[model samples]
Every structure is written in structure tokens, then in C-alpha cells.
Target: MPELVGTDEDDYLTLNYNGFVPLLTKAMQEQQTEIENQQKEIDELKAQLEMIMKMMQSDMSDKTDNKKAENNQKPVKLSMATVK
Candidate 1:
């Protein structure tokens, strides 16, 4: 149960090196683990974003193809004399 005390000069002052070294080392290790976990989460999010973008592009392409098909169809007209 060692407590870290901050000095007025924005520095740390510790009297017990034997206890402080282990505590500091543990804190550093914990911080490293947290950074690694956050990086993994960021990578996963980037992958998900890429997948979503691909799906959106595919959907847009399908819609464009459907519109082209509709536009390529010819219109039919009936004459009044033919009907008679």
C-alpha cells in the first residue's frame, strides 16, 4: 500500500524505492496492456467500416444496373386506325 505523492514542482517524490519500483513497474505494465487492447478494438472497427463501405458500393451498383435495364426497354404505342 504505497501511495504516490506529487511535489509542487510537478514532479514525483517517493521515499521507498523498494516498494515504489514494483508498483511503478506494475502500473506501466497495466498501461501497456490497456494500450494494446484499445489498438485491437480500433483495428476491428476499421475492418467493420471497410466491410460496410463495400456493401454500400455493391448496393449502389445493383440499383444503377436495375435503372439501366429499365431505361433500355422500348415503349409501345397503339394507333386509332389499327384499333378500328
Candidate 2:
């Protein structure tokens, strides 16, 4: 089995600075960036959902107001005509 420890000269440079493997550190940074991008997408989707919900609520209120207007209107009466 290959040794778990990476002892290449490039690894040595970073290992001396912060004890992190260069390859692994770069991969970690990339993953962090991806997470940040996904978080932004999630925030945008949440905003859209909120806007949709508000539109639905507004539609419901408008329908209710229309119904109330219909109910409050005066009823019409028709007069029967007599044939001569």
C-alpha cells in the first residue's frame, strides 16, 4: 500500500506554512466556493417563492372583494308586458 503521508517537495512547502497538503487544500477551497454558489441559488429561489405566495394572496383577496361587491348590489325587478 502506498504511504498515506505526501512528502513531495510541493507538499513540503505548504506543510511548512500551515501543515495542510496543497492538493487537499485547493480541493477544499473549491468545495467551499461551490457551497457558497449553491447558497446564493437557494436564497434566490426563496425570494421567488415569497413573491409567488404574495401574488396568490393578492388574487384571493381580489376575488373576495368581487364576491362582496356582487352580494351588495341591488337586485333587478322585471315588469311583465300585457298583450293587447
Candidate 3:
């Protein structure tokens, strides 16, 4: 609430432009400060998320390489003898 500088009820009710302007200006400044802080926080979170995604992709690639290596190994075979 803004302070009423005017002494009379009629002066206060008529709207004091001088007092109202400063109050509105202060409010706008406060809101801008809050918005800037929130934006900085959001940027930090996005950076962290990107790093996590890259790490996950690398892990998945490693798993796929291991599976391919296992599949490429040669299998062992046994010899059979004929009975008379």
C-alpha cells in the first residue's frame, strides 16, 4: 500500500500521480529481479541435464560393443570316432 501524502480525503481520493508512479516503478523492479534469478536457475538445470544425457549415451555404446565382441568369438568343436 502506498502512503497518503495528501492531508485531505478529496486529495487522496483524486489519485496522487507522484506517489503512485514510484510505487509502481519499485514493484516492476522487484519483479524483474525475480525473473532474472529464475532464468539463471533454469539455465543451470539444462546444462546438468545435457551432461547426464551424454553420459548415458556413452554407457549404452559401451554395452553394445561388448555384446558384439562376445558374439564374434569362435565356438569349439569335438571329433567323433566310428565303431567297428
* Best by the lDDT measure: 1
Which has the greatest TM-score?
Answer: 3
Q: For model 3, what is the C-alpha lDDT against the true structure? A: 0.83
Decreasing lDDT order of the candidates:
1, 3, 2
Q: Candidates' TM-scores?
A: 0.68, 0.64, 0.72
- TM-score of the candidate numbered 1? 0.68
lDDT of 2 at 20: 44
Compute the lDDT for candidate 1.
Answer: 0.85
Pairwise TM-score winner, candidates 1 and 2 = 1
Q: What is the number of backbone collisions in each predicted candidate, taken in the order shown?
A: 0, 0, 0
All predictions: root-mean-square deviation over Cα?
Answer: 7.4, 8.6, 5.4
What would you estimate as the lDDT of candidate 2?
0.80
Predicted candidate 2 versus true structure: per-residue lDDT over 1-84, tens digit per residue: 133445676666222444447767998999999999999999999999999999999999999999999988969666566433
CA lDDT, every model vs. true structure? 0.85, 0.80, 0.83
Clashing pairs in 3: none
Candidate 2 stretches with Cα past 4 Å from truth are: 1-20, 74-84
| Rank list by TM-score | 3, 1, 2
Name the weakest run of 10 consecutive residues (lDDT summed) in model 3.
Answer: 1-10
Against the correct fold, how does model 3 do in TM-score?
A: 0.72
Which is the better candidate, 2 or 3, if ranked by TM-score? Answer: 3
